[model samples]
Target chain A: MNDVTGMPQTAVVIGGGSDIALATLRLLAKRRLRAVVLLGRSAEALNEAAEQLRGAGVEEVTTEIFDVNDFSHASEVAEETVARLGTVDLVLVAAGFLGDASLEVIDPESVAHMIATNFTGPAAAMTAFSQRLLRQGFGRIVVLSSVAGVRVRRSNFVYGSAKAGLDGFAQGLDDALVKTGLSVMIVRPGFVHSKMTLGLKAAPMSTTPEAVAGAIVKGLESGASVVWAPSSLMWVFGILVHLPRRLWRLVPG
Target chain B: MIPGDTDAFVGWGNNNATRAVHRRPRNTKEIAALLEGSSMCIARGLGRAYGDAAQCAGGTVIDCTGLSEILAFDGSSGVVRVEAGCSLDQLSRYSVSRGWFVPVTPGTAFVTIGGAVAADVHGKNHHREGSIAGYIEELCLVTPDGPRIVGPDRDPELFWATCGGMGLTGVITEVALRLMPIATSYLSVDTDRARDLDACMEMLASGDERYRYSVAWIDAGTRGRALGRAVITRGDHARVEALAGTQRSIPLTYNPVQRLSVPFTPPVSMVNALTLPVFNSLWYHRAPKHRTDEIQTMSAFFYPLDMLRDWNRLYGPRGFTQYQMVVPFGQEHVVRYTIERLQEASCPSTLGVLKRFGAGDPAPLSFPMPGWTLALDIPLGSPSLAVALDDCDRHVAGAGGRVYLAKDGRMRPELMREMYPRIDQFLETCHRTDPDGLFVSDLSRRIGLTPTTPTQRKGMKP
Candidate 1:
């Protein structure tokens, strides 16, 4: 059922992921939607996530190996999720880099591969998810963004630029699904110190993944076309995206 | 409330008197406007009825009586133009004065023309003139789609449906039927005392061939051999010349004093065993043993109760129920067993009538048939009553018979589905006519007549 028009209603979470996507999945299941197919890169990793969902009381889950960079297996994982379960209710594209920004300069190839895995691969995954959502005449595409995308803070423009493109694409798709009751909510988080950003300093009033999950649940309930993380960032970015060129160059990376 | 009828007894299952909201619309256009986007609905006539047939619970009810109007009449052809709301009593008074009468009339004159057509109400002469539908020439029904006139040669399915449609399809607005020509405004009558139930049925059916009107009044409380014993009254419209010289000079006027009701209810026990038995005995004893007499007026012969005002209140707090079921010819055992059970239970019945009908009109849902029909007037308040008769409905169904939709209340949806296989067809027509499901009624809701609501499709559930 992972074809263009249908996706497994079940979803599996790969990696020890953020709580936002899982919280969203649990909400969908409450409405009696079936199948939450979860796929992580490692057997143990997928098992741990499944255990956490079961502990969290999520009723439906499917898991398999799905490494973002492992192209051959990653595509197969998407196929197998649909095969085992059925059409998907939603696709949480919540897997990608909060990698070492400096590693890219030391190894250009790593930077290029990160860009490929971070942007290109997810784009391919989204293409597949979109086909399924449209065919079913319903679906939600939730992709995470970072405040870093607010401006290329040259320090992590590679990640920021990729989010910029993803954010733009998600918004356009949201517009397309207006009357169909389907939508996309690209969440842009401000800097925070997490496992993803181990050494990074927390920004002012920065929120935890718990806060982000709460925000996403509220947004979905309100049938919002889109939602911003730390909601104040919506206005902050509104100013940042149009900052004066001379002042923008002076802002810290 | 009629005797021994539990299904017709509970007009509102939730017997909150606050629920009785009497709506009065001014005219047919208002009714037409109400039909928009109806999910489901049934039309209601006068609340004079003792059952839910004319009382839809929570849906649109077009009070067709608001459209009551006498549009035209051709004295030469005996054809009358009237709104569906025109009452049988009103029509009778108007036409009978001018030498015309309805072809068929139920015991009461308070029923509307549309109600008559909807129930296809038969009369003592049903074995002769058939049901009211036979006299119906054309009907304008506000169908699922909109108002459309249906005649036999027109929308035949709808024509058949509207005759006994019970307002499920839509409100019936105007009707054009041929008024019957009468010899005079009087009836020459004959009364025969029936020895038993069989003799009662025999006397009623056999006398029907000779007389235009025939009915049997059973002494409801009498048991065993006397059970089902009745007085068969048969009559023919009397010409002015047939009346004795002096009696022919009597005036033709509406009775100012008809049924003087029992003022305030006498209490719940008023209609119970002892008193009803006494009353039944008195009624039976009071009838003339075997008399041939001249009846002064057609209304007296046909609609003796038309003179009554607020008669429904006679049933007290829990209104009376009219339990009428057909036990087709061969299944005489059901009728016999039923009467025996009623005898055992000692259910008090005041007015018990027995009549026979010819095969009913083609209106697929019409209730009258070529079988025996017995109706009783029971005072309300009996929980076990419905359960008992529903067993009777089941037995009747098993014997290839059915209860009238126009008089039903407690029937289950499954039974309705089994009995009227064409109900779905009626629903489909409603859907097409009112796509948004604007029309809905209490009876439809009570009987599993539900309309599908819009829900989010598949995933991304909203």
Candidate 2:
């Protein structure tokens, strides 16, 4: 059971509104692990996600109506998550988005604020939660990185750069958690045409939210540090992310 | 040539179907090495089984492949006293040269003799020799209580239980059995083609009594009229004088080359709809139509396909599930119905083996009865795989048929409980010998093969 990564005994998914995050909660519940705490801004979405996870097989899932962006109350949310869940082993940080990528071209302040919400918010939330795991001497976290972070093309540099920062943070947390019996899985999904991608044109190597969710579970179970959507996109991004900035700019949109 | 107590553990033969890499103990004392606060252990033979029949799953598995020294053989009585590790095929080749052979063998001669006795295995000869249980004269078993020799006449209850206890009872170290006298190594085989699944069942059931071994290869992919097209094969050993010039050239002392590991995993599509169709076509065409021919070597006659090593891997990452179920004699229609349903669902199966049983010998949890059983291998693909098979399990149980324990992994405990009525009794013996559940297998955990959970028999009496 110790070898089992992630929070099997109790899990807290911070972005319950995200379908992929809710899917993870549901799967963990189905595995008969108790005390699932869904933390998100929308109480309705958190309650709905918790109910879905319970109905799917998670015998116990509680709702915590709190936003990750509220850094002042992040420690309180972590306490409530562990208090209700009893030894919360996992905290899935799945919040963040590509909110108005073109903003960097016109509004610099709005772009910075967007980056703070998408990257800084989750980083602060995770730091608050990680202390509890460090005290317990064991824990796992699944951080949602994005393919955009792998290569910040000019078309989406504003959103991509935020993910790039978050991705680096998750990797460092993963390295720091080692031998503490704590672990981190940074999932980098390519254009997962989910509810978030409703208006955007589907990217090449695009996959579904379900595929991303399934890959997250597989990666966590296999103790993989990182996972990419469409699976083959790992190699695709591996090469694309290393191209010279000028050469990267030449790639077709 | 062997010591008085040549530890009675079953060894791995050519069948590498177990997780011996997990635990390997040398003797009963050394075998006890894996107990780890557990009271007892079971000797695992060649893991040729399709399911948890060989594994203790969460417990220990002792590799017995090294215990295969054939201790002694009596020429006149055709009795071979061999270590548990010696296989039916090994015994056959060794005995046949001396004008003797193991009386009963499972379809795959790759199975060890200890496995034969433990499972009470039957073959094309089941209708005659009954089973390896009937031919088995004695079993030397080691329990937490220590080594005990049991036979039908010596310890009837323990004897019957150990016959099919799935290694839960104790370690079957050595087996003594009646070996059939053979004039030659070849079989005089005859092939008959059945038009459909129904025809195949009927043809095998009606005429299996006429030959020493009888089985049909079903083309599960066939639909409508061809839904069960099969090639039925039956044969008896060809006498030495009857052997042709070519067959006579094969010497009596020939040893088969052992199979090496699969060097590389082929692409996942190797056994897909397209490839399997071609393979099946080639296989069906290669059979000699209704020809009575003499074949050299039991390996070639009974295990020609064994040459293709790790054939199961051909199913790709979706590890293949082998479903072998036997229904009663009057229920050939039920067998046909099941096949029809599979065809209707368009479930791509790689293989289907159909055979007939003469009569049930009343081995408490014996899988076979007086009827037809069809074993099919389905590679896991869609989510429907489990649901589709659960339906098949219902149909089989409804027909008074049951899935072979050797091939089961994911059967529901409810179905298993209903299928094996004396399950409680089996557990009683398992606890009596292995108090700590040292022989738990993967199949046991999946199929709820252990003691019934409280929820299972909510209101029923214990």
Candidate 3:
């Protein structure tokens, strides 16, 4: 359960191997977070992240195999996680696929995989987790969306469209759970220098994984439904989202 | 069955509000029916609990206020058998004029008898007398197993569990409470101002046994030499000879009035960093250095905060958390450390109360012990507030103390066993009577007192 300050004591990260998710868990561990369950496709990466969290003062760390592309077992995975932990105070959805926009636009197979990883799979997993959280009567779900979803850019339209779907879905999920003990928080980082964005051109107001993790923790404490990393991106995207199509296209990626 | 009114219910702190179906049972049968119909529920009094002890999210909240009826009152024996919904205010008004008073009361008279029992409330005189649990002769608990009349001798395990059980044992339908006899409705109070933490503790430790009731109002905002400056007040019920009046007429008159009320919650807390230090300084300076035998009304001496209705709104819409913990008698340093930590963190506490507690009752979850307790009402806006309070929790638990469950909205579940060593026994008793854990509240869930699995009725969907 979350403590008096609304900081979660027990957390489950779906994309356990994700750099941003691990960073956020580390920060939460420093704030007295006791236990964590890391779920990801790679057993090696999940074990590494779990060891790091243990060293960060988390008393208990467990790893489970989870695949974003395996949509059939989403509900089962969520149920298993809850059954194993007894009570999960927070669930972090940080799985994403930043496929090559130029190549994925032409390759149907890659586009399908990217869409499933970024949108369909995560939405299914969150939906399943939300049911378990509702049964438990109290928990928070934080999904990592991106600024690219604010206005789907032509530069990475395939990835941006998938993020847009996820961003909208998370916002709606938050509203649907109103008055229930469950809440959904959406974190939109402008651009983070992590494994997923390695070698990619740094966007304006780009941030580090640690900075985004800090924002996520702050967002959880403040009970904000949507959090923008670097904070300035909220205003930056606010204006850019409304710009003319011709000017928007001319804006740098 | 009568339909319940669905609404949002918050504790007196006005934070952590949750939606629940509120059923006001007019009689025991109705209460039993409501309990039977709901998968999870808890009894609620006037909602005076500072936290979520009374609220059950996504479940039924049995509003016991409507079941208020004084069934029997023995004037000579001072034993009253009243329905659980009867408030201390109502009972005091009826009994005080008859030369009797409720044995124990919290900081307010608005609390229901049921709540007083559930929280095992202690008063200013706790160092001399124990909590309300000691005054309770018997309880008519309506659990899933049915109504059972339990007392100290009859089903002692269930009896002790029901007391200070946070309504988890069952809905307290009725309580047979032993009222204390009184000569008058007023008290003869002695006030003293202490310069620092050491002086205040010395004064209270040395003088508390001489008086029936004693408490200290601490100035937590002050630092350095002035740190923990306090106003210590000790009193006993004023006798007829002590009442300075015209022929001693109407000596037992007991009419308490609300002089002021906060009408609405402000956008920000009125008791914040800017105003807290000033209030504490003025409150400290306003106290008399040494005054003896000053006649005061019962309300003025005990329930002063009750004078202003909804005073919690002074903390604004964010509400406040009352961090009340008791360290054993020898561990006075924990009390000082707590106050110092709050001051260092800049978490302005509007009201700080320091009291000496006597031996605890048999109830496993009961909060009081032979210790010095400090309760601070801190507004919830400070960013560092959570970490600071967490630090206090560790220190209190380390020193063999525990936070009051009724007043706690946010406490770490892992520390529950460490603070309350008898928690496993308490849970065992609860499960024996309520196998499905029907009586559950947000506080129970937050503190890990309830069963781990989500409760589901036989035919109910999860």
Which has the greatest DockQ?
Answer: 3
**Order of the predicted models by DockQ, top scorer first:** 3, 2, 1
Name the DockQ score for candidate 3.
0.25
**Candidate 3, B81-144: lDDT as tens digits:** 9999999999998999899999888989999999999999999989989999998889899999
Q: Which run of 10 residues does model 2 chain A get worst, by summed lDDT? A: A1-10
Task: Give one digit per residue, the lDDT tens place, for model 2 in A1-253.
Answer: 1111221546788777888897766665534255577777888877777777777877667776776678899988886666565345577898876676664454877787778767998999888888665543346788998988888877788778889999999899878765444568889998887778888888888888788887876665444678887789989987887789889888654
- Place model 1 in a CAPRI quality band: incorrect
List candidate 1 segments past 4 Å from native.
A1-253, B1-23, B37-41, B246-259, B421-437, B449-462
What DockQ does candidate 2 have relative to the true complex?
A: 0.08
Error of 2 at A202 (Å): 10
Q: What is the interface RMSD of candidate 3, in Å?
A: 4.5
Off by over 4 Å in 3: A29-88, A102-136, A151-169, A172-176, A231-251, B1-8, B19-21, B34-38, B244-248, B454-462
What is candidate 2's TM-score against the reference? 0.71
TM-score of the first chain of model 2: 0.92
Q: Between 2 and 3, whose DockQ is larger?
A: 3
TM-score of chain B of each: 0.88, 0.87, 0.97
